[model samples]
Target: MPKGKRTRIVALTRTRKKGLDSKKKLMDDLRSCLEDYERVFVFSVRDMRNAKLKDMRTKWRTSRFFFGKNKVMAIALGRTAEEEQADGLHKLSKALRGQCGLMFTNSAKDDVVDFFGKYVEADYARAGAVATDDVALEEGPLPDFPHSVEPYLRLKLGLKTTLNRGVVTLLKPHIVCRKGERMTPEQTRLLKLMNHPMAEFRVNLVAVWSKDGVVERLNPDADGEEDEEEEGSGAEDDAEDMDSD
Candidate 1:
């Protein structure tokens, strides 16, 4: 081959390698976006082009909360978490396999909690029903994704809230699952239990951090209730001492 032809071939090969390198770098950047975050929230996406999820992600980014796509995140799960997390995290990864949004923050827990509350409030009005399993299984407060269970506040609790309805109402809202169906008794029971305790999403998520957190570990289910009672009793005892003084 001519010297000029050989040079041309070498230049083309370098350009191709550069293109591959650029693609590799992009993937690495996406993965870094996931791994560097302090917490990972895994969610399922029903609609691939979810406008609400996109909006939530944009809102988080505006507030300096980093959001990333899940396919990229799944890669991090595969590479980062232990083999045990692989099954559960991978299941979560599969749930998030399609287009979904993520929010990241190194900010205070309250900030994250506030964000969740706002999101849930926004979506509550528009959502018909949410999956009880999903809500119960979530690490924190229910998401602010619309098309969930905020439409009917009358049926669920046999009570009503002034916020969703008029002052006369004394009920929390009823949630319908996808396809405009009602949640089963078990699901409703779990949701009502969580809601009554004012168990915010972050609180539950924090519980995952301890599997009990503020609640004692011995009895699991019974302990959370007992812990609250103990706190109440302690407060009463403090009040009595103050009265004696």
Candidate 2:
């Protein structure tokens, strides 16, 4: 081999090693986040138009979403492609390949999943879909509904479903995520306290707690009112006069 070619090969090897080291460091960081945080939200977004991007910048006044390379992320996650497929983290890997991003937080895992599911449904609904399957959903952000349901429903709904204020209504309020739009200051501030330990959810009047508490809703048939009459204190004539008036 030529000396020049040999030198170039050696340089490339060193660069590759450095890259691997950096990726390992990133993986460790993510793993640490996993330990510290209770949940993570993954997003898939198409490339924004220039005008839309500028509008998002002004509207959100927040950091732009980051699109990390899939290969680097695989390394950062310390998972081989085969292993990811085996373990089911591969979907996250696949999403990273497209126009995608992720949001990480230490909030409740159920809350995070709920948030992502609602976020996607909100966007899909904005495109004009009539109803979302969120009512029946339980665990994962991704669901396996009947094949006839999903993209078909979304396509029928179409684009222009967005509200004037840009808040996509979900089945629940806590799970809302407004893309390319600024959340009101109130919303941002409220999110911080939303994942609180004592926080509860009520369907009708029953309260459901985050940790492990439950309150049952009142059943009308279960509770009957007393029909017993009290002894009258006022004169019947006076009562008749009052009613007459």
Candidate 3:
């Protein structure tokens, strides 16, 4: 039998934050693990989806990921987690300039890199995320919606809707939003109501430190601030390619 809304999966709304002792423990743990691991990869995080990250962490169970304050993580690796990581990990921590994390693993670099490149998934667009595509609500019956939501959608979004046979129907097709624009709150609500996906989250590996004392920038030309389709200066690329072994 089919389940009701009570049995539906729900995402976590709030994440547990670290306290003073927890932060120190993380640094201590990372510092000690630095010696035990052979290869280290620095990854940046943006619009982090904690649940998605937790799932990815589980997938890479063979490796270790440390996400925290860059300075603390840097200090754990050596004298400078911001300027330099370790002797072999020089400039590795510099990639930690923004929201960053450290990945320690004994895994092959090629395999790890390939996995990250192929692992992009659509995420719910949050405030400030650039729209990846045009999202609209067509003139038609909203089958899945309950009849009660008609008023809120009409009043809040300026949507032309009417209740017909206990279902919300749009009077005319309208552009809820356009591409290449910052997501607005009303548009966000409309997207949720219409079940439209407008954002893509992917990891962009900017730099890597291999086991054989080699260091390299994996995506030197990757613009962090620009989407894959857009062209912009690299200086503002404060985006990410987060996590894993």
Candidate 2: list runs displaced more than 4 Å.
Answer: 1-18, 47-66, 78-91, 108-245
Error of model 1, residue 65, in angstroms: 7.7
Q: Could you say which candidate leads in lDDT?
A: 3
Query: Would you list the rank order by TM-score, best first?
Result: 3, 1, 2
Name the weakest run of 10 consecutive residues (lDDT summed) in model 3: 231-240
Give lDDT for model 2.
0.32
Which model scores highest in TM-score?
3
CA error at residue 206 for candidate 3, angstroms? 2.0
lDDT of 1 by residue, 69-121 (tens): 33344554453336322234443343332223333344455566565545431
Q: Rank the candidates by lDDT, best first.
A: 3, 1, 2
Question: 124-178, model 3: which lDDT tens digit per residue?
Answer: 7876667777877779998877888899989988889999889899999988777
Q: Could you give me the TM-score of model 3 versus the true structure?
A: 0.75
Off by over 4 Å in 3: 1-20, 79-86, 222-245
lDDT of 2 at 7: 57
TM-score of 1: 0.30
Off by over 4 Å in 1: 1-26, 34-36, 45-50, 62-72, 79-99, 120-245
TM-scores for every candidate against the unseen true structure: 0.30, 0.28, 0.75
